[model samples]
Target: MTQTLVKAPFRADQVGSLLRPESLKKAKNEYKAGKITAEQLHEVERQEIKRAVDKQIEAGLQVVTEGEFGRDWWHSTFMEHLLGAEGYIPEQGYNFSNQETDPYDVRLVDKVAYNPNHPFFQQAKELVEIVGDRAVVKFTIPSPNQFFHPNIINGQYKDFEEFAPDIIQAYKETIHEFYRIGIRYLQLDDVYLAVIATADFPPEEKKYLAELAVRVVNGVLEGKPEDLTVTTHVCRGNYRSDYSFSGGYDTVAPIVFANEKVDGFFLEYDDERSGSFEPLKYIPKGGPRVVLGLVTSKTGQLEDKEAIKARVQEATKYVPLEQLCLSPQCGFASTHHGNILTEEEQWEKLRFVVETANEIWE
Candidate 1:
């Protein structure tokens, strides 16, 4: 039987979030210090995001993000905006590969539910209006599992199962709201699942954790709109270009690829740490498309186009070439501080992805 090809937003896409420009950074700091009003900060963001969107179009990407300028951190911004959540600083940092993150977390203070006026939703609306016909827009949020990170203690529930239902409901409502407001593309940036995937747990323990991750995500995705294109971006970790985990998708592929009801996947494959493309075999002949993260956002070094194409060809051994696309291994700026690369360098990397995809897939 012939396998039908999976259509995606673009042959060349990104994992969302671009490096924050100096102007946006300054405005954010000003707003935080009360030196500028919210209106003033938003004005800056509006202008900066316009520029970012233009840059993405110029790089030949069909789908672009607002660069997540309104966010201080990837997950914290959206989580903190939840109606029942509150933010707090912790005593220790989230240890990563060779570095540690500053302490920050969002706790459940009330019953979990969606906030009608989520700032991220408003930002997505602005981006689509600004982008017009130039390109499609995607808004990314950390997964619901992020709220239950072990480091975070729930203030309202004694156990995760006690509140998983509310969490699922809140996310479902949130997704529906985005669709109602005209958002067709949404990406959930999740490191928790990847962390579980890479951890060296016993076989049974690992499968159990992976299954739990899938259940929570699928719960959030339950009854999603058909027109909505939802995808998940898995990363080992990305904080100021530092990572927390390593290993391949082999362990979690069966759990995620077969269970989670996402339209596609943005997978990390930039370095040796991510293992091989062998696990692509488990993707099921005609399931979700896979976006190869052959380009790295952690550094400014440009990858050879021929090398990237060759790697994509290698991946085709498991999954058909038509089922594959290309993107950066992760966002250039998972946090507002941005990665270790310069803005120009980041643009170069994106341009490379575009050029490589054009040469291979177009």
Candidate 2:
């Protein structure tokens, strides 16, 4: 069989389609309304997390994540939770492509400061203990590059170039911290890497950013144990019923695919927005494997089984079938408010992935 989802479950308050029963929602509403303390919200999350973990294992997934349960948003949740991060509410253009975006520039409060007290760092160390065996515990962190990616400095950057030094340092430390905590399957969520690779940026500029991303991420892996399984997920975007950046992997191509310092590449190929499978050839013929996100997490609709099989077959033309795997194009949800899909609908979609894999590989 091909590769399986290294981590398949979601966490409580995770950025996916899993639900927290109405009771917890009602409690959260009360908490937000000033009737309860933060402790109440924490209490609910703790209880709900256990239930989410149980449900994931029951579904037969072997690699389970906390579903980013404690995180608020997917990309920058870890940033805000960091010690020195503060919001830089901007008075400017939108950060994403969708118009429904709420305008408020929430930039990192600090330019640089690595406080050693990140909750996810500590939480991940304990996550495996709570995950309850039979599945490899997995965790997703923003790519080191994104941590220091200079954004619109008044609509551009003081210098996207200036971000390089700090990006390297910050990511190096962040990665080691996870390794120290005993993390094994670490998935670096890298949207920006693919974005710059495909954008109209100058060739030198794109190469610089790609090289820097690899430098920082790989630098973090410099002295790691061989057992570490590092994977990267190149998502277009997943927000509150919104999509972020969009472009085919064709833009990034073999550069981002071959450059990332990882064991696998989770490429989003759910729809036309993801482009064709020809780019799969850019992936080094015998390097890391590719997890084809043939199943999509954007909606509840399951993929046609025969069609997905055919697509997978087509992909083997570029990369060997044995080197391929399956998964939802992106996280079912990448924010506290997940995409508009029922929980049952989400399960059916995942069931399709598992069933499809069973037929194709087993």
Candidate 3:
């Protein structure tokens, strides 16, 4: 299939959050220990982000991200920065496969609202300046659905339905602010929907949760600009190469794939844990494109190029080849600890994605 290059969510896209460089990690530790000033730490972050952008372009990726260089946890960093939300240590950490994440989580302390002066705006502006037309700058944040996690302490609202409106309004304003600052491509890193799909809920309960997910997401996208491209990366969890959920998209495919108002779906298909491409049939014809995450970010091993292409071909059984793209299952570093992969291995995996995508789509 001959694919035409469009705006964001390029054929060889990524799920943001790259592995942090040693220098930046050291700076973070120093700042945490009060050995370095906030200004000094930010300086190092700026430098590292610039370098990360250069590497993305060099790796042949059309979309460039700051690698979420300034964040410790991809979701919490942005979530806690909201006007009415704050971070707090939970009683227990999130349990993943043989791993437990830090007990940190975000909660609403009052009515949620977008904070225009959120530091992410400045970070997006800096990324725009650094890229300078060389490639498209894509900004990523956690989905409003993420706030519905059971681990999150909901201090303001009685339930998700009541909490939905405030978060939806907050995200709507936030998206506009991103557009004002020159972010044309925005992706919501979502682990909630995927996690729910794996839950042992009754049929009606599952459907109810799925419908709520669509409502929350579509609400935020109610009146987004025509030019701004928004995509959602449905993740199952990514902490130190450990995952929290395991199941197919069967439960939520019909609801989310058919209703969520987004330009594309960056679905994870790196392993059997994500299930078959059969669920992808729920994606209506000419609807949002499906970016097939054929590469794995949890490990350093590079997949066979031909085998990856074969998997893409296999997915065409449900979705047309023209409507499909390729990327890693998730980000290399979803948190500050980073995945169990060397920096060189991470680049090699990305480069493989670019080369393989070109062979299949170009």
- Candidate with best lDDT: 3
lDDT of 3 by residue, 194-270 (tens): 87799998999889999998999999998899999999999988889988888999989999998998999999999
State the local distance difference test value for candidate 1: 0.85
User: Candidate 3, 343: how far from true, in Å?
Assistant: 0.9
TM-score of each: 0.95, 0.87, 0.98
Please report how far candidate 2 places residue 21 from its true position, in Å.
4.9
Question: What shift in Å separates residue 264 of candidate 3 from its native position after superposition?
Answer: 0.5
Worst 10 contiguous positions by lDDT, candidate 1: 1-10
Q: After superposition, how far is residue 320 of candidate 3 from its true place, in Å?
A: 0.7
Report the lDDT of model 3 for residue 300.
97
Residue 38, candidate 2: C-alpha displacement in angstroms: 2.7
Off by over 4 Å in 3: 1-3, 150-153
Per-candidate clashes come to 1, 11, 0
Candidate 1, residues 111-200, lDDT tens digits: the string is 878898888888888988999877778888898878765445465877767777888999999999888878888998888878788888
C-alpha RMSD by candidate, in order: 2.8, 3.8, 1.4
Model 2 lDDT per residue over 1-362, tens place: 33343433211111233544555667777888999898887677677767767766666556667766666566666766554454454556345666444443335544554557877886687677777566677788877666545552222235655654554566667767887887777887887776775588988877777766776677666766677777888777776556767677775675677776577888888887777898888788767778888877777877799999999899999998767877787776666667778777776776677678767877
Candidates' C-alpha lDDT: 0.85, 0.68, 0.90
